[model samples]
Target: MTERQQQRSPSSGAGAAPAPPPGDADAESGPTVLGFAPDTAEDDETVEPVADGTAARVAVGSDRLAYVRRPDLVGGLLLLLAGVADAASVWLPWDRDGDVSGLSLVVRAVDAAPEGIAELGRTGLWQPAAVAAGGVVLLVLGLLLLRPARGHRVSGVLALGVALAVAAAVVGRLVDVGWDARSFGPGAWCAVAVAGLGALGALKAVLTAPRVTTVPAERLLVG
Candidate 1:
């Protein structure tokens, strides 16, 4: 309260709070780039963010199909699964006794082929080798399609043909079973399923192929 002591009072510092250390503001906000220009406050103007991008510019009257690009993995995977099913059918049961799988059927036919023509009935010449081969072919085509490549249409067409051929084999063999019998087993149904899946996958592979191209583009900075 005395005049001399008033000069030393805490309020004598102009009644303002102590200034913080020079590094404290930068530390609290973020690191300051001392060597570069000082940063200005951020502008509040509206902006739409977009990256520098290039889009395919199609030629005049060009085929749109040629410019389109799509991944064939889905269709190819389906076809591959169909082929796997067909091959797996060889291990599944085909008859009431569960004794004759697709592979066994091929073996039996091969064994019977050696019998003389006169003993044809006794030998029972029946074969499904084409089905097995078709499955393998489809599997290969499917793999080709799944990878990045052109000519998917060709692979699809071939796959469709193979599927139809195997389908015929499946149906033809089913003609002999009577209603009273145990009828077609899992192997037979698997054959049918593969045929259907192969057809769909092939169609998709051809129709869903992607076409792509690159064109000049630029990025327009807003701020």
Candidate 2:
């Protein structure tokens, strides 16, 4: 070849190839770099976050029981009101007559002798005393119903006790001549019936009540 042709001969050696691009040091073993193997990188496993104090495990059953029944609470409150009314009758001082204000109504009802039964209205401290004792018992029982504890059996027993006490009071009232003219005075009958129904309600609440369980914290979260 001529000397000028040889000088511009593509500056090529006999058969040497171009050099390859530099390889990533962490590409194969570590997470892939951006734009490379993205699909495979996403599939890589990772640990989930956990609560600080509790373990990762949870119980689904207990979560359902946390909700309380409104009807049960209503029944319990009704019983409590009945107890208060019964207690008020002991100190209402109705035996004196003309004490019919809202506050004194409860007292008058207990000692009210009416016309015929004035002699029977003599409380001798025993009758009014017995009623007050029963009232205290009923109040305690009603409060127990409000608690989260299992009170089905306890409530039923308390209700029964209230019913019995009211019945005895009514019987005592019937023998005396008072505002109530009949052998069984109006007040006596009402007290008996109210206490009996209250007892039944408490017993029913206990018998039909469903079991409640605590819910786990994990179940509280939305999916």
Candidate 3:
């Protein structure tokens, strides 16, 4: 055979190494045999690893619903009545003499001279009339705060204060003058009744006031 033919022939063995099998050759060097085997590496995108001695904390918020208490109708009504009684006491007679009303007592006390101040005090009418005026203002404020159930604690405390004032004024007058029915008129008795009713209503309102609270909601995590 010619020299070129000898070189191309498969049978030629001299000066040439033996060829390896296809399977062994591929396992060693062919294209790395790309394939999808079960991946042994940790996926940072899907899995999170916490420290050995630390806990993983997720941030949460108070995005939930809240509940409120109902209005106190009975307490509101009592406060309203007390306010009305206080206003009426201004026009009603404060002494056995029908000519002397609460308004006239206040006017006389305001217009009295330094020497006449003692005369006004001796009658013991001006003190209760002045207290009645204060009661009217306080009771009106309490009613406004309590009617719609807004500021229950404030209104209740205010009502209690008015009751104490009215009681003190009436008792002081009775102590100074006399504790007979002839000493006081219907207006004075009406003020006494308001003190008792207002105190009861204030207690009820404070006891029945509402409390508010919040709850946390769960968060959804997507991997």
Query: Per-residue alpha-carbon lDDT of model 2 for 1-223, expressed as tens digits?
Result: 8988778746366675755445654455565557566452122222334666533432233233474443456556766776766655543442334333323433444455453344434542334444555666766777766666544566766677776776576556545545363533333334554566566656665675555667654432211
Q: Clashing residue pairs in candidate 3, if any?
A: none
Off by over 4 Å in 1: 1-71, 112-127, 178-182, 209-214, 217-223
Instruction: Find the 10 residues in a row with the least total lDDT in model 1.
Output: 56-65
TM-score of each candidate? 0.57, 0.45, 0.57
Error of 2 at 151 (Å): 4.2
Ranking by lDDT: 1, 3, 2
Residue 113 local lDDT, model 2: 45
What does candidate 1's lDDT look like per residue over 1-223, in tens digits?
6888867857547776887898977766755587554554334323443355533322232233334434488778988888888877778877756677888876766676677544433433242655667778888988888766654888889899988887776666665564333577777777777888889888887776456665433333444
How much is 108 displaced in model 3, in angstroms?
1.8
Candidate 3: residue 149 Cα off by (Å): 5.4
Q: What is the lDDT of candidate 3?
A: 0.65
Q: Give per-residue lDDT, candidate 1, residue 81.
A: 89
Local distance difference test, candidate 2:
0.53
